[model samples]
Target chain A: MHRIVAFFLKQYPFFLFLLLEIVAISLVINHNNYHKGVLRLGVSEVSGTTYEIWSHITGYFSLHQQNRALAEENARLRSQMPDAFKASDRKVFVRDDTVYQQQFEYVSARVVKSSVNRQRNILMIDKGVNQGIAQNMGVMGSDGIVGVVQSVSANYALVLPVINVGANIFARLKSNDQKGIVSWNGASYHYAQMKGIPGHILVEQGDTIITSGQSVFFPEGLCVGFVTDYVQSPGDNFYTIRLRLGVDFNSLNHVYVIRNLMADEQHNLLKENGDAE
Target chain B: MQNSPMLHIGRFAALGFTQILVLNNVQFGGYLNPYIYILFILLLPLRTPPLVMILSGFAMGMFIDLFTGMMGLHTAATLFVAFYRKRIMKVVIGVREEDYLGTPGIRDLGPWRFFYYAGAATLTHHLLVYMLEVFTFINFWSVMLRTLANSMVSVVFIMVAMVLFERRRHG
Candidate 1:
């Protein structure tokens, strides 16, 4: 008994270190965004408050640039307005009443904290559950798709951006309508990889990529990126394509959280179908 | 020589605050993040108990992780460094010189020795962090590059900080 006690006493630091490391690794592996969101609320509040103050000071310096970007986005949106398209048949009165139900709604929020360098990067936005934000909703910047909301607290939410290695978004090429999965390779923030794209599809440089709308998170036609390059392994059926992401993650400030109204219904139906199968 | 517990606590608060408020915001090319917060562990008095060192390491790491939402990457890495710090110190400044070693600073161990000690600890911590962070060898080269790049910046920052801020103790 004395020897055992002495042995443990001599190596208590090692034991304590091991215990703490185990706890950390378990927290990393087992605790998903739900737990992280709740666990991080206090920390986020403090960090977010500090960041808000810092951004206030720095916001003055970037007002012109931000205004220009917002203006460009506004112009792009204006060009897509229904009024911008001339009616081919002036005689035909199209009744556009109750036929279309709004599938997604956007809630505007400011990014309070973000990091691009980490392999599994996460971002914090100022809006949370109180502002109609929830887990698994999609987030989009003014320019393009940003990320998916992983978790939400009362007043803050965490976003798992596309730059994260664990992030995978369904995307399609606008040129040929071929679908692929977009994911980061943990290398460059500017570039992400598109996988599961069959080699036969003729993809070209600068071809636009958009959300496939196959998932419940993001709606179709949301801009993701443009193809920069592609290559196929000798015997593989899939071509690994590189993309230039449209959203500049490093400078992300304002974003919109997308609330999909029918997500739960669709998910339940799919789950039932899978069970039946 | 043992320093006052108050000094250690003060250093902890200072380094932790700087790490979260200042260093966390500083990133170069989305790769080089200099985590000078580990300087707290590296600068502890040599005679401090290993248990205290390890506990302090976990506390500091947890504080940074909480603020950054990195989950537990920093905590795990810092704990590893704290556990192996004595071994690393002995290796850097020969086993025979262990008795003469005080707190690891430029003043205590001289520039070269301090550099080796801090560099080894920083690299180990950074490598563990990036490895656990990426969690896969899918882009092994990229992870290696990130580790090397970040470690270089962190080591330089830690050395410069030691030189600039460490109080010169007279024998």
Candidate 2:
């Protein structure tokens, strides 16, 4: 007992360091499974509020650019409006609304805080549970698919972006519908690698990659990126295709969170089929 | 040079805010993130108790973590800087900490020695941070490159800040 006491007395600093490190590591490990507890609430709320205020102050700096982008998107959307099309004499028929029920809904949210330099990048947006935001919803910028919602607080939601090493976005070639998984290689924010493309298929530069409507997160044909280059190693069946992502994560501001209305129904049907098999 | 806790506390808040708000946002080539917050740990009084140093490091790291949502990464890395700080200081300064007066900075150790001191400390901190963040050795070269590049940027930033700080003190 005396020896132990003396040893501790001599090495208290090391012990203290070890103890604190363990606590920190445990916090990291448990942070993933964390529900909306008091500590998380407090931290998220404070950080969320601070980021909102800061973004508001900084938001003015880029008002002109943002307005231009918004105007361009508005122009593009306006061209798709039903009223924009003139009356046609050749058997024009209105599509029945009941035949095409809305499967996806979008909630517009302003990004409060975002980081792209890290291996695992997360963005915080102003809308949260109060605005009908939930886990696993897909997020998209004006240009392309952004990320998926990982967690949500009452007033904010955290988005796990495509640039993160942990995120995998299923994308396909716009020309031939060749499917592949787009994943970040922890190298650059401007690019990601598309894997699982067969070597036999010829991939060219400037080939557009869009989200494959397979996942419940993103809708079909949302722009993901463009193929910049690809290489097929000898004896390898897969081509390692490099792509330039459409969304510029560094200057990401406003985004739309996509909530699939039929997600639960599709998921339940899939699960039931799997269980039966 | 002031031994007051208030001085340290003020430095803590100032550096912490600078790191979280400004430095974290400043990224070059999407690879370099200059972490000047560790400057707080590096500039602590030489005679500060090891326990105080460790606790302060942990507190500062947690404070940054709360804002960034990276709970353990900063805490673990900054704790290492705190733990090895004295040894690095002793190596660079070639003197027992007890014999030294005032916080170590560009003014006290001159620009070159301060650079070496801050460089070693930030390198150690950034290496641990990037390694732990990647959590793999598969891309060891990229990790090393990031560490070296970011450490250089951070050390340069620290040197410039210390120079400005010394100028202010003198004026």
Instruction: Please tell me which predicted candidate would have the highest lDDT against the true structure.
Output: 2
Which residue pairs show backbone clashes in model 2?
A: none
Candidate 2 has a TM-score of 0.95
Best by DockQ: 2
lDDT of each: 0.85, 0.87
Best-fitting candidate, scored by TM-score: 2
Error of 1 at A136 (Å): 0.8
Q: By DockQ thresholds, what CAPRI class is model 1?
A: medium
TM-score of chain B of each: 0.93, 0.92
Candidates 1 onward: DockQ, in order: 0.66, 0.69
lDDT value, residue B148 of candidate 1: 89
lDDT of 1: 0.85
